[model samples]
Every structure is written in structure tokens, then in C-alpha cells.
Target: MAKYEAKMKETESSVIEFIETVENPKKREDAYKLLEIFSEATGYEAKMWGPSIIGFGSYHYKYASGHEGDAPLVGFSPRKAKISLYFATGDTEREVILERFGKHTSAKACVYINKVADIDVEVLKELINRSIKFLQETYGS
Candidate 1:
């Protein structure tokens, strides 16, 4: 069997350059704000994850099946339709916070918001911290 490789590994690509390419002015601006927020919250400089995601920190995980990969502890992508917030899944506190996270939609692994103003920044920070803690505890520092 071939060794598994993750496509979204960290890159030397410039995060600021990627954000500048976001055509939507509002989304671009929101991306900048998110960059600041995630940076402050994670205390890690942002890195470009794949082509789109602005990621902070990282962790390695291996499933029971032996699939292993590294992923950002917290990240986001300002897509054309919505901003995707990446956090640790299966976190009970995360679910509770999402209930009061203001206007947004969520998938199993991502929370989607139309813009920064649509959600509570304080709550967002809490989510970032929670995700980092959860990943660290589950996977290791």
C-alpha cells in the first residue's frame, strides 16, 4: 500500500497574497480581520494551507486505520459565498457555543458565516482556543 499524503500541507505561499486575490471587497476585508483574530487567538503566525485556507498552529493525527496527517488547529477560508471557520469536531463545548454564535450555518467540520459581523468575535476567539486545546489534548502538543 502507498503511504498516505495530505494534499493540504503547509506551504511557503504568502497568506497575504492569497487574501488579496479574494475578489469580494467585503470578504477580502473580513479575511484580513480574521487573520488578525486567529493570529492573536492562536499566538501562531498564519500560514497558507493549500490554496485557500489561512491556518494557525498545527497538529498530527492518526486514525485507528493508520491514516495519519497534520492539520491546522484553527483556520478559515473566505470563500465567494461564505467564510468557512475550521475548528475541532466532536467538541461538546464547541456545539454549545455554536448555538449562540449568531447568524451562521455549520457542517460537521466547518462553520460558515457570511461575514465577521454576522458572528460574535468573542465567541469566535473562544472557538479557536477550544479547538487548539482539544487537538493538543487529543493528539499531543
Candidate 2:
């Protein structure tokens, strides 16, 4: 089999510039606020992942099938419709926190909220720390 390549690799793009390009005023503001929250929670500087995501910290993982790649430990993107939160999946603590996270929808890999105010910031911080811990335990940083 050919080697697999991850599409969402980190880039040198300016995160502030990317946030400035967000067309939605509310989403743009939320992006800045999330930047602050994620930084304070993870204690890692924000980085631009691919073109759209504002990420903090990173880790490498290899699946059972040998698919391996580096990804941000925690991140968020202020998309057109909703802010997509990226966190480690399959974490039970994350699932538990989501119950009290307020109005939001979740997918297999991401949590979607209309805005930062829609969710409990404390829960969000817990989720961020939990994700970082889970990833560091599962895959060394």
C-alpha cells in the first residue's frame, strides 16, 4: 500500500489574518474569544491548521491500520454556519462534559456551537484539558 498523507497539516499562515477573513461578525468575534480561551486552557500558542482551523498544541498518532499523522490536540474553527470544536474523540469524559455544554450539536469528530456564549465556558475548558490529557496519554506529544 502507498503511504498515507494527512491533508490537515499545520501551516505558517497567520491565525489573526484568517480570523479577520471570517465574513460573519459574530463568528469572527467568537473566534478571537475562543483563541483566548484555548490559549489559556492549553497554554499553547494558537496555530493555523490547514487553512481554516485555529489549533493549539499537537500530537502524532498511528492507528492500528498504520494510518499515522500529526494533529492539533485541541482546536476550533469559526465556520460559516457554526463554530466547530475539534477535540479527541472516543473520550468518555468529553462525552460527559458535553451533556452540560449547553446548546450544541456533536458529530463523530467535532462539536458544533452557534457561538461561544451558547455553551458553558467552564465545560469547554474541561473538555480542552481532558482532550490534551487523553491525547498525551494515548499518543506522546
Candidate 3:
């Protein structure tokens, strides 16, 4: 296994346990579905990131600020308040997509949506695929 995969498997128990305690079946289901979508979209297997995120692919990165680390290429965690989506890269079309995303808030590189039901799934899928493509083109092994 890849090093990260081993780490993920080693931590799988904690990850699954936290998902069980999240107390929202629908949110949990949405997270699982998002994993499925990302997997198909990226052709990369999903790995548990810590005890919450379901991460797809992997990459090594260094910031201009001197912070550097290896992490999942893209990921998402279904938090109690919202679904947090992480993209290591930025998309210029983000604003256009956000206008169509229904209800969401975004920081520098993450997008938070209250729930899957609150947005258009088709648009979500499009944005997700676009983000994955952007990453692959910009930073691929």
C-alpha cells in the first residue's frame, strides 16, 4: 500500500466510529455519496482522512508561506452544520458556480454547503468534477 493508504487504514476505526456518532443519517449518507461521486470523477480510490474527511487522490504541496505537507488531493467532511468541501486548487469559475450552488459559503479553498438538499446536485457534481480536473491539470504526479 502507499504510505498514506496505510495511515488511512490504520486510522479507519476512528473514522468510521466518528461517522456513526455524527447522529445524522442523511448527512452521513450524503458524505458517502459524495465520496462515490469523487471517486468516479477522479478515478482515484477514497481514503479516510483523519476521523472525518473522505479524501480522494494525493499530492505533496508547499506554500509560499513556507508551510509544506503531503495531503489528499481533494476531500470533504460532512460536519453537523454543513458539508465541507476542500480543494487544494482554486477555480476562477467559483463565483459563477456559487451563484448557482443554492446556499453555500466559501473561504480561500473550501466550500461549505448547509446540506445536499439545499443545492442543485447537478451543479454540485459539475463543480466537483471541475475542481478535480483543475487539480489534475495543475498538479499531477
| TM-score of every candidate relative to the true structure | 0.97, 0.97, 0.76
For residues 1-141, what per-residue lDDT tens digits would candidate 1 score against the true structure? 777778989999999999999999999999999999999999999999999898999999889998899889999999998999999988888999888789999999999999999899999998999999999999999
True-vs-predicted CA distance for residue 127, candidate 3, Å: 1.6
Tens-digit per-residue lDDT, 9-125, candidate 2: 999999999999999988899999999999999999999999998899999888998788889999999999899999998788888889999999999889999998899999999
How does candidate 2 score on lDDT?
Answer: 0.93
Give one digit per residue, the lDDT tens place, for model 3 in 19-123.
Answer: 567678888878767767777877887777777777777776666885556667777888888889887556787667778888888888788987777877777
Q: Which ranges of candidate 2 are over 4 A from the true structure? A: none
Q: Give per-candidate clash totals.
A: 0, 0, 0
- lDDT, residue 61, model 3: 60
Candidate 1, overall lDDT?
A: 0.93
Residue 23 lDDT in model 3? 75
How well does candidate 2 match the true structure in TM-score terms? 0.97
Deviation in angstroms for 52 in model 1?
Answer: 0.7
> What is the alpha-carbon lDDT for the whole of candidate 3?
0.72
The TM-score-based order of candidates, best leading, equals: 1, 2, 3
